[model samples]
Target: MKSCLVVDDSKVIRKVARHILETLDFSVEEAEDGRQALDRCAAQMPDVVLLDWNMPVMGGMEFLRNLRQQDFDTQPKVVFCTTENDVAHIRAALDAGADEFVMKPFDRETLESKLQIVGVA
Candidate 1:
């Protein structure tokens, strides 16, 4: 099964994403912040990362930069999942090496479509 890491500070958001990804046949893991997510990736890189923009320990942009610097067997696709809908934020994420973007309050279909676009679904 494809693996996915859901990085979000909110437990509710993580739970929701976990359920949706599980239904899509992804082996899901959760991280409360970018630091933990990076650690998780170091141990076992997932096929996709659903990352939030803001967090206490490292933000998504920083994580993306750090993640892109790593040498992995197959670099995981990163999709920014956040409420930041501004063009600057979106552009920043893409420039930071994110493969896709999904806004907050996303549903199954939205998540699936973004994942598909990143070739993770």
Candidate 2:
């Protein structure tokens, strides 16, 4: 089965995202911040990463940069899944190698559609 890593500082967000992914038949894992996400990436090598734009410990942008540089086992397809709806942030995420950008408060359909676009949903 396909696996995913959901990264966010909020416990509620993580739980909800995990439920969404698991419901779609994707195995789910989670991290509270970018630092933990990075570590999880190296260890678990999930097929996709749902990353929050902001966090206390290592922000998502920095994590994206690091992921771009690394030659990891999974080389996960990343999606910017955050509350930030600004154009600049979306552009930055795309330039940083995210396969897709999904705004927060998304429903299962919205998330599925984005993943489908990337051949991962």
Among the numbered candidates, top lDDT falls to 1
> lDDT tens digits, residues 2-106, model 2?
999999998998998999999999999889899999998888788889999999989999999998899875588999999888899888899999999998898
Expressed as tens digits, the lDDT of each residue in 1-121 for candidate 1 is 9999999999999999999999999999999999999999999999999999999989888889999998877789999999999999999999889999999999999999999998878
How many collisions between residues are there in candidate 2?
Answer: 1
TM-score of 2: 0.96
- Candidates' TM-scores? 0.98, 0.96
Flag clash pairs in model 1. none
lDDT (CA) for every model shown? 0.94, 0.91
